[model samples]
Target: MSWPRKPLFGSIRARLLLLLLGGLGTLMLALFLLLDFSIDRQIFGRLDATLLGRARGVVVLLESHPRDDAWQELHELVPEYATGGHTDFVQIWDAAGSTLLSSASNAGNNLQRPPAPVPANAPLFYDLRLPDGHRGRAVGLRFAMPGRADEAVLVVAEEREQVDQLERRVHVALVMGVVGMGLLAALLSVLAVRGGLRPLLAFAAGTGPDGAPRVEPLPVARMPSELRPFADALNAAFARLQAALGRERRFARDVAHELRTPLAETRMAVELATRGAPSAQVLAGALASIDRMQRCIDGLLALSRYEAGIEQAQVEPLELVDLLRRSLALAATPAGKREVTLAASLPDECWVMSDPALLERIVDNLLLNAAEYAPADSTVQLALITSDEGCTLRLGNAAPQLAPDDVERLGERFWRKSAAREASQHGGLGLALAGTLAGLLGLRLHFALEHGVLWAELGPLRPIALPESPAS
Candidate 1:
């Protein structure tokens, strides 16, 4: 079944980073707001204290002088005394509650400071609404004159509208800063992710990442240190791949070269046999040659497919005894002409996993090679034994002793023990093809020379349960 494909960024990186940044920005903005509020509170607190102190001092001066010029000078001093970003206005009142003096902004404005029961020494700041209907922080202080029966209170206040406006400006600036930084961070993250993926691109560009001989190695030093280990691993993998491909390439070339001589000779012999007045003996010989070429062509095609990784396809269970019985049946005809007896040693119900066609081909090649090389009237035996690991299939023939090197090189294409034997049909590529197919199917194929007998086996059997008949 096919799955839906998504866009690269939307499916992978962009969404991940956006979610990450969104979380980070939210946390950062919360902290920024908290800190901004704390600082604003401290700053405004200090401004309130300074304005209250100046009001207290004004009340003492107004009670001592009770004059217009002196009160006006006291208000002028406030503008100079107040801290940066703070403004002040003052209004002086007589004992009879008349406004004696006031600043320009407070002209004809009377602020009613509601009476509270507190200590005479306690001068407090409170929120008061003036006659103009505006809010301000008002500090009121009452003092008694030395020679008068009445008491005068000097009140001073500053408009608090600017504090609220400052808060709004701060909030806007903070939002803009967070948005700007988030954009910059996301851009850098994209660049960083791309830079890290560059080495993977280089590794993918090679001809084959697995075992192919033609694969080239990349320069490891040019890559980042974080990616160096992966590059080195790929280089090692390519080395193994190159070796395997080299073997396969050589096998193909050698098979073609070996088959060409017999094919060309067969064609020539047929041409001569078909000409006028040819003997029956010559015709029979030509027919044999043609048969040999046909067998070689068919074997080579099967071997090529096996070598090219076609064995990865699923194979059904093949009864081991049935497979061997069929192979011996076919090989018996050829063996009898050469005075060789064929035999099979196997259980009645042994089963295995394999492509029956290819398994049959493997068995035919092994038996044909053994029959040709075995002594006359000798038994060319094919044995199948059940074991703990799997089934063991062995084919043995009476032959001369094989050297250790010959056993090691037995399945190499075009390799033979003797020069004269190399020219024979049984020598060059048959065993190599059998071995190749066995390997592709994950089976072990090998040769051993035991006491002047050469043996080829295609197992350790993979066991399976046989199906039961529906009725006896």
Candidate 2:
């Protein structure tokens, strides 16, 4: 699928920063919420304990004697007992359920008793609404005075909206802190992410000017652990690119060298034909030069396409023996000129599935290469080995010039024999292209000298599918 060449607001750097900071913001907000709840619970617990203590103090004061002046000291000591401007409010009821005593702080409000009979000395804490339209907490108890058997119910209550409001303010501040931190973290994260990717940016500069090697490679030593693999891969690719550039320049130079003679001859002939001096011969020479150039160009293109694709477009089952015979026939006149004889052993027919043009090219290159480099008056052998598994085409040529070490470089592009023993017009793309063709055709191409005879073999060919049996 194709995407827009450039999309707005869709960048890896921006997306990464967003994801990183968003996750952190969510985590921070959750922690802050938990913290708010924890703090609120702690504050409310402490406040409830304080209110309960004040309620107990009031209970203690009400049980004491008033004539001993202790009540005055009690009023001085206890906040709820003193009553004015205090948050704590108290109410007491006699045995008949009459409102007996109430704190000035109550403002005529009281905690209601439970409808059932009260349990003695038991205290219950509950939430209630105050007369002033605020929420309150109340502690109620049913108890008798120090000497009386009849029951009295006492209550202490306080407005809680203020503490609740304060807690809300704290929660708001915490939430604001989360928001502020989120923004700060996002900004910092963008900067940090950019800084973290700096080395990668430096590692990835534009490719050097076309058809040239890079001046320098990326610094692998300084790359962080996270990006080391990426750096290594880029370096590897750069190395391959550099090698390809070198090979391309060499190939071009070889092509120019091969074409110079033909192109010069063609130019001279065209000039002669223009002068009307035996135009037909000059024209024929020019046509031959053009055909030579066309062949070289075609070979280069075929090699390139083969390297770039695993399979050629038009593939079919090729008859290996017939292709081999045709290639040998084409090589015979050249071999006869060199006084080199051709020998062959093959089946009546051998079949392998491959692109026929590519197959023909490989066979043609192999036979011609053998004929070109083989010793004059020597015999070049051709043979094909076949089985139910696969087929291998072999070409054996007499190559007295090739050493053990020289054999290894035979298929390298633009490579030639160390000393030019004969005048041959061809560039050294034949064997290299043969190798590429073998790869594209799913065959093996290699050379070895057994008793000073160079062998160029291509196969085992692509596997032929076996026929399926009918259902039993």
Candidate 3:
């Protein structure tokens, strides 16, 4: 099935920018709130001091004069108190809570008053709404006239619109300043993230897919310290992929060369049959040629599927003894045709953990190779040995015609001994397939030429009972 391609949210720059936005925005909000609180505390604190200072001054004036005419005398001393935009009102309450003196025309008619003040306590400051419809602040204090034994309550209040207006102006400026800072931070975050990721971008740009493998490394020296390790790992992966691709290309050429032989023979067979030579023998030869082509195609398919790394192996616990017996039984007919004796020294219960179908292919290929290559009237030996370290299976056949050099190239694709090059059905892929399957099943294979004999050993299968080592 095909799907639409979508750009991933997998960019380092976008992630970094989002992270900075969240973090910086949170910090700015907290700082703005703290600034607002500090400003309110300081402004209100100064207002309280001013109110209390005026009240204290009025109390001193009252102590030096008589109560009946004190308000008039205070107005004469400070004429601005009689009428002004930022005027203060002073009220003195006697023991009975009756007004003794007032800055306004009438006593107890200005604003809502507070509880009588105590001399020992701190001054009480609060908001007030005057009868004249002005909003202001008030401070209440307790005092005693010099000649009187009775304590009196004194309250002083003044309009606060001017101070409040100043505070509102400062608040607007602070909000604008913080908002501007946030915008600046967002812009900087984009530039910083782009600048930081430049090395990675260069690395991507340098490594374009031109369909050829090359030993090119990412420029790790130009990247930041944080990305150097990742670049190093990427370079190592590129080297491995290049090697794998090289092997695949070589194998593809070998397969093409191997297929050409049977194709040419089949073409000739078809030509002969069309030229008045379509006898049973001629037709049979063509059929045989077709069969050889089919086998070659099948082998190529198996090898390609194995190399492509697509198939999921269905694994199970398998007994190797049964698999070996079945494989030898299949190879017995060919061995008997050449008068070769097939012998095995397998244990009663040789167990292994592997995919059953794949294991069968491995065993069949091993037995077939031994049967096909053994000398006439010779003994083909299949032996299995197990120890604490690992297990080994050795398949050896007497081969008087086999040379030392050919043993080394045993598992290579389409490689065959010069003496056996004329065989049409065998493509020399049997041992190669066995080696590939063994490696896939976590086993190992080695080939050697002993005294007038070819030895192929497959070993180190993961133990069925013993724990397998964890793959790195």
Candidate 4:
């Protein structure tokens, strides 16, 4: 099957690649610019120094020889200045600003002169076009001749084609280097991002061959620290889901088991009626069987609804004493039929925040269960004990046949003390339904057995104070 397409920009891998390359590209561009500037500065500084030295040498030649001979000696001393197709050029001016001597390379063409006068001690370097129309660097200075009182200005220049060629070559190399490094960095970033996300991919694929989630918990020790908390949360969620599934399976099995006998009895009653048994007795037997089946079905439905969160508690302030008294009164007939006495010690007005209907069901179930199970002459004792933290309603009765271990199983569905007790009107769902309802109302329902007495404690229900009335 084809998978759904995801948006291009929504991929985390794409976003990370974009960020890594964008940042590194910027850094590389900056590095290229800086290196270009430094290399250019160093190359030109050396050229300027060399040109200044040549200008100094021209000054020394003019000082040592007479004015007439110095011009002739210049050609022999610096032969490059006199050669044809040469790269070097030199010129000198007298005190009267007239050209005293010129290199043969000039060929009657003049070099570009500076607008400002040359300094006596330091040479001035500048860029200019030479006589042959090539870009060149020049250095000019003023110096005193030996016999004359006036100083002469000398300018020396050289063609810069070689220097320009070298600079271009260096720039091309730098561009190539930056581009290569950027490409390498991009490749490495892709590898690192994929490797870093491998664990997450593995975690997402933690399923069985049938594509169901595995019940086993993930190995937290092998996981990266950054993902451990996420792994732990998934493990907890899976555990809860597994437990809910197990409970549902058991419930389904128990429901089928409980309904089987009633259905069989109903079929037997109808068969007896067909065989000419007394019509009234057959009808009554069938009705009783149908009623038992209905009770079991209704109880199962109620438990399922509560567990599935279909029923929500409507909470309000309720007087606990009044609700308890009503539940006890309703349970009196059942207790009297069994010859079991019912007694209670409650506070005057114990106000509590609880769902009225849900709490009433819980109290009624506790009272009925106690009364039905207590010995004929024994009393079912119920007491409301209040404390600073909360109030607890304890209901206890004689349970001579029950063991301590049985107390833990008190709220299980369809659990009876004996098969004979199954003949009673209760399908053994009273305590289970009560416990489920109490949980929905955020109340605790606990059971304990002590010295042949079974105690059911329902709550740590904190008391709510009543609103004070306005004075008339």
| Candidate of highest lDDT | 4
Which of 1 and 4 is ahead in lDDT?
A: 4
The parts of candidate 1 lying over 4 Å away from their true place are 1-41, 52-87, 92-155, 158-248, 270-275, 311-314, 465-472
The candidate, 2 or 4, that scores higher on lDDT is: 4
- The 10-residue segment of model 2 with minimum total lDDT is 1-10
Model 1 whole-model lDDT (C-alpha atoms): 0.70
What lDDT would each prediction earn against the true structure? 0.70, 0.75, 0.78, 0.86
Off by over 4 Å in 3: 1-26, 53-89, 93-99, 102-136, 142-152, 158-169, 196-255, 277-281, 309-311, 399-405, 419-422, 462-472
lDDT of 4 by residue, 1-472 (tens): 2343344457778777788889999999999999999999999989988998888877877788786687778788778877845499988877788887788988877888765788778888889998888899898899887777888888899999899999999999999999999999989988988987788778677634465656899898999998899889878877777867776886798789898888888898899988885599888988998998888888888887788667899998889999999999998999999899999998788999999888998999899889888999899999999877699999999999998888889999999878887666776788999999988988899999888999999998879877899999
Pairs of residues clashing in candidate 2: 339-377
Instruction: Give lDDT tens digits, candidate 1, residues 1-472.
Output: 2343344344435565656677767877787778787867875687678777877677666656756655566646655322322345666566677775666655555666536532357666677765456666777766664445766666777776676577667767776776777777667767765665556655566535464433456677777787678778877776766655665786578667776776676677678867867877767666666666666666666666666565553577877788778878888887898899987777767778877877777787898888777888999888887778888888898877467567888777667667777446553567888887777667899888888888887787588877788996
The better candidate by TM-score, 3 or 4, is: 4
Residues 352-428 of candidate 3: C-alpha lDDT, one tens digit per residue: 77788987888788888778777788899999889785678888998777789877788887776774565547767
User: lDDT value for candidate 2?
Assistant: 0.75
Q: Runs in model 2 with CA error above 4 Å?
A: 1-29, 53-89, 94-98, 103-137, 142-153, 158-195, 205-251, 270-287, 307-317, 336-339, 372-376, 386-390, 401-409, 412-428, 449-452, 462-472
**TM-score for each predicted model, relative to the true structure:** 0.64, 0.69, 0.73, 0.82
Q: Tell me how far the alpha carbon of residue 373 in candidate 4 is from the true structure, in angstroms, after superposition.
A: 1.8
